[model samples]
Target: MSTDKGQYFNDLRTIQANLPTEYSRTFGQMIVHYYLHLIKSSHTQKANAKGLKQQAAGILQEFKRKQSLRKDYPATDLLVWVAESNHLPQALPVTSLLKEKKYRVTYISNKQQLLANPALEGYNKIQVVLPKRGIIAEKQVKEFEAVVSSIIANTNLAIITAEDIDTISKAFREYVTYTRQLQADYEKVITNVNPKAALIGYDIPTEGRTLTDVLNAKSIPTFMIQHGAMAKVDGIFGTHISKTIFVYGEVSKQVLKDSGTKADIKITGAPYLDELMKKLHTAGSKAQGKLKVLVAFSGPGHLTTENHHKKSIEAVMEVAKNHSGSVEFYFKLHPKDNRSYYTAEMEGKNLTNVHFKLPHSQSNDIFDWALFADIMLTGASTVAIEAMLCRKPVISLDLTGDYKELSFVKEGAVKLISDKAELNTVIEQAVLQNFDAFDASSRKAELYAKQFYGPTDGQAAQRCAQLIEPSLN
Candidate 1:
């Protein structure tokens, strides 16, 4: 359990590189992206290894279960969509536009639960297809198992299995077979459709990358749309693999450009942002409240390594207890976040004006609260950028001081504060509209919004569609 992150990441890469050649060539590319989220507050260096072993087992079991259930895909030329829930909003408008232009499109949702999500209601009709005639061959699984066992026995990768090697020796074996089978599913799907061009949102996720890599390997064009703002991280996130990556505007284009990315980065105004701006500009001013403050949580695992996720809420609510009548604080949880924990925390406090924004039925959801809030607080989340697009003042509690790469903060569109005192002072000023601070900040936010989101004419989806239409030719 070392604090040396450099050593930890190095060991991670070594384990990934040592994966069975077949998988290392495919799934290994994004293993770090997955592991970065796994190393939450409840992890240690030992726990990290144990977690990977368990993850491997789960994957293998899932694939083995699927061996009995195989289906064939539709045989036809098509347009493929690999957008998950997070990517749905950015994808829906553009996909809709393409369909309107008479293109054959099918959305292959990765998660079954997404079927119930309100966003996909009308766009849910999909091409239920598969080219494979049968389930996983027994020989494929056994061969992978043998290769992994042989490699683990022959290699120097104690870093991956050191914590509980004997108990989970089959872990690596399962992992290798799972990736192989997973890749084939994507390949078979692509073979069935022979897609004109496949589109996947911000392609660092292993599942998305697997699908796109399969397409890329087949020489089928692929597009990785800008799902959110860029963050500063080691290669754990935002490594593009698609034939082209569509960014929102100049700022994100520059961020990816400076990252030394090999993929072509093009400026395409965000599809979701276009709709939000349409709603925002047509909507009136924020509703009446004393000092309307929205504190949004970016979930517990991603950037909350030291438990800053919980503490930030404590800091905000702790201070809110002081000015009961003058200010109201709204707590907005990320869609995947637990509601019970925050509900309990606010239960017996007897605090006034503290409320939780429940999930919205609208596709992108948080636009209502983002519009309602006069000021916002968060840590290294794209929510800050969305709030900036709404021209709301944003404050981030950089408790660790390592979030300097947060885009809005870097551009001076958001205020960066270190602790509770500053949070209180900023909230007070934001409430009083001290010397046109709100007006001045609003103007600054809009100027930068043009840079962050490009044209507000609501033509982003058209622009994106035009760029993607060429691949069909």
Candidate 2:
């Protein structure tokens, strides 16, 4: 299982480094194709070449089917692009609210999860733009090669291997063909839809960048909505091509300003958080018992190595062991993490009080977990902010000093602990006493919410709708 996971992650890194970021989803599909080929090759006792050809043919057929479904539609007032199902919630509220005002809103995504989202059913249209698999024409291929060669010759990427170059070349060829096809399809849709403005969840990824580039070329206004907490201001939101960016709070807006980002910034808060706050306001408190400590695992991006994950889990288990029967630890896994990896790591040692929870299930929503947790612990997850919004004390473990600059620590929203001793002390204090009962911590939590997430009122969606209304008109 570890070998399988390692190979899988290595493939992911290769694809991520070589292909356009938007193709990350397509890379998963490619992995499925490869696995199918491997299984067939093993069953037939034959060379894998035949299976590879079969997989390619199958991908081509599906690509052609998706392409055949493309057709012209009437003009729309607004076009919203969402990359994943998780982004659907942020897009839904604004689109739904806009629909009431009679604006024609259309949604587009390459991900099936988003296309199948029930929340997007009320939109004017929902289109899925699947990536195509095939070689481009010889002339276009030559032109692409020449362009890449020039870039390689002049760029400072001095340590790339021949294998890396070959991988990048192949990936770039696919990206070029796929993006051109997408551009053609999107151009037709935009021309027929004739949307005055387009709204995207975030504009840093390759998909958003490519789509935004297309829309900007046609002089259509574009807006990027804040989908999550911004650890820093110099990323996608800061340097995106969108004319306007809708953030969740003044803090994010000010961060952009300090970073010298050239875009109109608006604080609409977060629609999902607004709704969660409403539920939290009415929901009953957790039943009193052993103090529940929730530890949120940062995703693969931050926990880059298995050792990092192992060490983090070890730290939490140590705390749980120290507290024994007095406190319980709930380990919340990141959505993108493989559950088996953590489960295998914790199979022995018998930490009886430690429990694992998956992300985004009925019982494990960050907000729900926050409500049940007396104190939340994490390295640098957005859950720190969510926990604070739920009135839970947050202990940010910065053992490696990676989280020192994060907004939660920098803004005094959480208790930052850099050493094991400090972590133990903080956890003991949190478990023994009502940490939220302290006036200073309560005030700090409130300030964190205000600075990080503008308002708790359930009008964030309406506010976003109002911002897009003028663009539609």
Candidate 3:
């Protein structure tokens, strides 16, 4: 292995050491062990290093072969970059609507699995290749090195430790290096596709940000589609990358405005949730007998702490003890959360009525869960808004006492509970189907839905398509 590889491994070790205990225990430990083994084996045996290189080459060759099989379609007026499978639903509708307007469309994605998406059937699908490490040139290397150095020098040592600084520098170096490599490929694709306009969903870290930069350099008008709730701390939204941003509602538009974003903002609701919300509204109120509560669990990390998880379980168990056979609890785990961690956490707890629902796929319809649930509970998840869209009462378990400023709580979309006593009272009211008893009214939920999600009349896709069409000309 090269000296740079060894240094990278050392940096990973430094990062692993400084990571929070919960993160290190759950996920970061595996990454640390993988790099440790790779570095150790490379030093021990040259053959092992050769074998690892061969394995990577084999993976790359297979990827190229699959990409070669994709049929090339003529350049289109619009190019839609699908970053994640979750974004496909939002992108697909806009692309489909564009096709109806006689505009040719091409779809590109880094994840090959998305090519099989039924929604992407009629569109052209192209697989994106992320540049491998060590492919960056020396000139680019110096440029990125300077950028990393400046970042490190500017960082406050009081708040960030030397180890943290080193780890971040190393990570950013890799990001810049890979991004430079991917930029060349993206430039080539854009030149070949020659789209008059491009569409992307959210520009933050990784591929989306890099792609936005490339599109801006090429003078292509790129529109950013809102994917989810925008927080105040999400500084990436304020960057002047895309030409325009299509947000879900006026609230999101204002958030970007307050953040001093340079892009033009338009309210188009949520394209992906539009149809789902329409269907849910048409289905009317579900027949209720027993109290059905849906608990949306946040992924383990800064969003939800171990203490929050423990206390949430304790509070829910207490509520269950009182209601017993009259109520049922459905615990929905976040896509990134480990099912085993939640299962182990609930072990030995005598709660027969509580059931766990693990995320099966990116296409899993959470709206169905919202439809049946009379009330939803979560710590700080976007699903609270989804539940409110379905007219279901939302209860935020603020056991950690840190989520006082969450958008749902601030907007009165959810009832915040900080203790077992509050949890019991909220659950009791929810069970009786009299959430208004606790001052959590249906009118508040309705207003929140409108302000947060705009009009969910199944026309957001059309609005987005219309917004992108004029830019193409």
Candidate 4:
């Protein structure tokens, strides 16, 4: 990478390091949802309460729509809140994927606008606004606290640690900013616990704070999740969470020991990834047509701290030109990002071999495309991990920033790069390589699942449900 590019990547990492804990990512989402609701309700380009009320109304409609599903299954009163991803396959597909495995699922989050429209009425789902039995408010700290406190009065909390605080802080604003307040509240909850443990999804939310202080405050067992596959540079991976941290792989466990987290950790794999692994096993259905590779365009506000997304896209375009005839390359720009962002670089050039996917294309369709593709390409993403599990070869180019330092991509598991030249070569290799050649990597993906999670039998939701079944009953 050139000096300028190197500096850019360095700056990106610095911003990532400063990101609020992952818990904060949800808060950012809420703010986005709040504003978006405001925008759509007014039907005007202006921002005001009218628009916000419209957004809230839309969410309420979606909640009622989802709630309608339970009308027939009265015995199933417990609300299952699956996180809604506006990016990859919305919450419906997630719940559908879970249902396929015989687990009943529901929608519970702020992004309920997607489900409110008449177009989604074909699907039977119930959404609860308030005064409902369950709330899937992942980052809605105030509401989440109230609900958890009511149900799990004996609930314990934990915080997973990494170098990124800004990202987490932005997502879980109320929880992190009001740490002392939350800590005091949690103390009251931990007073009643004996055998039950509440696993807080602390995916890299603890950074600047001392792990020991947080862990000690909650005498209740506080558990954490290993963010990704481990490698050298994951400073003190297992040492930060309570004595019982949940890791994805043995490498992560070893890295934790190397970092000095002496907590007795368990390998719960990744609860977040359980849905993806299920897709991999059932993808034997041969998919026809072009082997597609999707490049998700994320802006500086989300995913990247630096404005290198266009540069990365240009590099992929350069490589796509090489095999455009046989292999297909698609770009899914972030909802917030637009084509104008790349006006200078892609203005005159029209690469017939490449295509740009608008936000209308659901993330689930992309995942389905990933299933049929000969290989998948990305800059730096957890999506690469999912691609690997789907048995597709992955080529992760380090277009900019501290991508080389990420624990998951650092391993040879993902192909990293700095510019168009390197990405071109990686893409060429990925497209031509035989699928069978990746059996070992796929198995490693499975092992990554088992070591961290305990099973890959497509029953992760069922397994998770098993843990919470008695509570619901």
Candidate 5:
């Protein structure tokens, strides 16, 4: 299994260097993000390339499609906060708390559907940034296409063929056009809103970069919020253009530092975790029926194979099937995961107590699952950290043996397990015992968790608000 990008990343970096400085800053770097996701979960080059060509063809089609719109943003004086993936639950309390501080925050989302979320209901101004629009300027295609060919031809990739470069180059041109449209739309937003300052999600994502670039040129300081922990290949980390990045804790801050991050990092805690912190301090009594077990699905690609992810779920379901009388299982999917495929798997099973939770912007989040379950089961997802922070026991299920030792596990905040039989045993014992039986383990988990993301006083959002409030005036 290919644990690291190895030669492929070297090849891509070579391409990044080949592109002219102008395009290299945005589009060239975007090329890297595209491939990072492409093979992010695939542990082997064989698995990674299984459908890569077809995927590339599809991406070309998507690039050539109309995905954004041109809009005349109205004039305003609000401080614009652009969150593509970091909407509602993730940006929580920080956005709301800032509003309370009298910062008229205009929330912009790239996911068009997020504006309707009930969690964002009380917000005064919320809008969606259309993801893409029809191709804009065809004016400068040949020159960039030549640059694309030069970059592709010179780079020796572990995946993709010389023949693939032709299709890929065309897509690159389309992306250039799409990115140009994004630049135009954002410029319009700037001209109309005259944003006070800016706050964005990740430093990656061409969309976020376009916004940051436009905002930066206007001397608007942009702050990025850290929603998840950083892994080595999560993306290009050191290349941030934001003035500063707001992180969850020192652990994340240190990781960013090691990755050569240039931006100043402020540990503001995690707003979602802060909510869990409040509930952790005064958790209501557990219902007296079956033992509640929550299975938080995360990192099928980054941590395990898609097949192994399925195996982990099957293991949980089997344990539930065997202990139906004593235990209930809740499967919480990552927002990017599809529920329909899993829905079909549960169709014929008589596992009546098995529950499925589809988490959206405003719906039940991982914290709610952590709070409601007696024991949490995951594959070392970031949720394991969040669940532990909520004072819940977390078991990391490893199927392909591709597990890495994260700090939390070394700190004993999470336990890594592989045997399915052992999973059944844990469920049976916990269900047969008192609800408080796992209380000691839960408390122990919290001790390590505090070191990971602590001060569980539930003020992470407040801390972020305090930092951003000063720049408003």
Candidate 6:
């Protein structure tokens, strides 16, 4: 098991060196990271001991051998994703592979069709209908409860929560209700499924929350998969307490030291970015003409506190109005945001130069657009990391206060734009800047990402799979 664990991580070293530079540590957070990493490592040690005793090494090796030989063997179950539309695209490759590996696939949408879309053949989907009259919170919990009951009975639970803690953008207090409901619903689902092994995509940003309360309370062996640059969010301390944490590069392993998170942190490069890189390369040569810029706004979170969606839309609209034909702006809305927000700002205006993109578009489709864009704009979306992976320039706009905590912004991979006027000037300069030779700072940042993310070779998922299979009993 130890040898398997070591081998799993060794594959990730190359990936770490390839991480983007924009994912650097900010001041004051290093100490906390180190301490947290230490704690997490200790927890992993304990979990490993249990696995070692429960399943012997000989059987584990045999399982691997069987996995190799039985490529055509059908998986016993399927993973059903009933998530929002934006998040759905990210899971596509995973779902696709699961099917190829012989596992059935199912995807659920929050709205629209009830009988599941035909395009998702062999994949099952259920529409989430809410009670029309009740409070939104009550409706969500009740609806989730029904789904949880059905899923737990039919399939092995494949839990995927980007982060355990949900934030409220309005008043800090408003977060309490959503947070509580999420916790309650998640707990109910996990309890019913009684998952044998679970995967955590990233470290949980836990400050006051307890891992045992959110997870582990039921003793589920969670396998953590590092989703992006090794940036820490709140409740990360709790992540240190997870049974095991998987990472992609050495830089991320080092980041745990700074964030004070200690898990048995293993390098498993992110599959999402890996696939993106592959698609970019296969698309043929890089851009030849005017740099296309895609501007994305991640809404209603720590950065856009107090429903600044209007302000954000106004800011983008102002840019569209000003730049119209000079610079083509592709606006990608956050999955969580309502389309009404975009319609409210863009409806009657009839702006042809600007395209406002919604969720559900293939991630690759969007990436295809982003690849040609000379520059990119965003308000704290991890898409910045994607931009770096694509070798495109990016700017992050922070309307609210939490920009400092963002790793890429701190590393200067992204420029901070606080207001509409400042954003306008920065966008103009970035788009017009000649790329005859990539900027030195930009090159340096890319080198930094190599360390932060691992390899740019585009096999993050394969690397992650090797890292995980060994550890699972």
- On residues 1-473, what C-alpha lDDT tens digit does candidate 3 reach at each position? 01223234334333444544533321121332233233343221212234777878967865784464354557889988877767887888788888987888888777788777877777877777665544335564455445434543554322233334344434433444455556666777777778899897656544776677678877889898876666333333454357888888877888778755779889998889766765677543744688888888676433455556766776786787688788888877776565675565567767777777523433357787777677788877878878878777778888766666556677666788888887888777767776664365455877877888887788998999898888777
Q: Model 6, stretches more than 4 Å misplaced?
A: 1-195, 200-215, 227-242, 250-257, 260-262, 282-291, 307-309, 347-350, 358-364, 399-401, 430-441, 470-473
Worst 10 residues of 4 by lDDT: 155-164
Q: What is the lDDT of candidate 4?
A: 0.45
Output candidate 6 Cα RMSD: 16.6
Q: Which regions of candidate 4 deviate over 4 angstroms?
A: 1-197, 203-218, 224-232, 235-243, 260-263, 272-279, 282-289, 296-310, 321-326, 332-345, 351-366, 399-401, 404-411, 425-454, 459-473
- The true-versus-predicted C-alpha distance at residue 306 of model 1, in Å, is 5.0
Full-model lDDT, candidate 1: 0.63
What RMSD does each model have against the real structure? Answer: 6.4, 7.6, 8.8, 11.9, 6.3, 16.6
What's model 2's overall lDDT?
0.66
Cα lDDT tens digits, model 4, 109-141, are: 324674474534534333323222122345555
The digit string of per-residue lDDT tens for model 5 on 58-86 reads 66645543332344544433444545444
In model 4, the Cα lDDT at residue 68 comes to 41
Ranking by lDDT: 3, 2, 5, 1, 6, 4
Local lDDT at 55 for model 5: 72
List the candidates' TM-scores in order: 0.78, 0.77, 0.78, 0.51, 0.78, 0.58
Q: In model 2, which regions exceed 4 Å deviation?
A: 1-69, 133-174, 282-287, 302-307, 357-361, 434-442
What lDDT score goes with residue 409 in model 3? 73
lDDT, residue 112, model 4? 63
**Inter-residue clash pairs, candidate 3:** none
TM-score between candidate 1 and the true structure: 0.78
Q: Which parts of model 3 are misplaced by more than 4 Å? A: 1-73, 135-164, 231-233, 282-286, 305-324, 357-363, 432-438
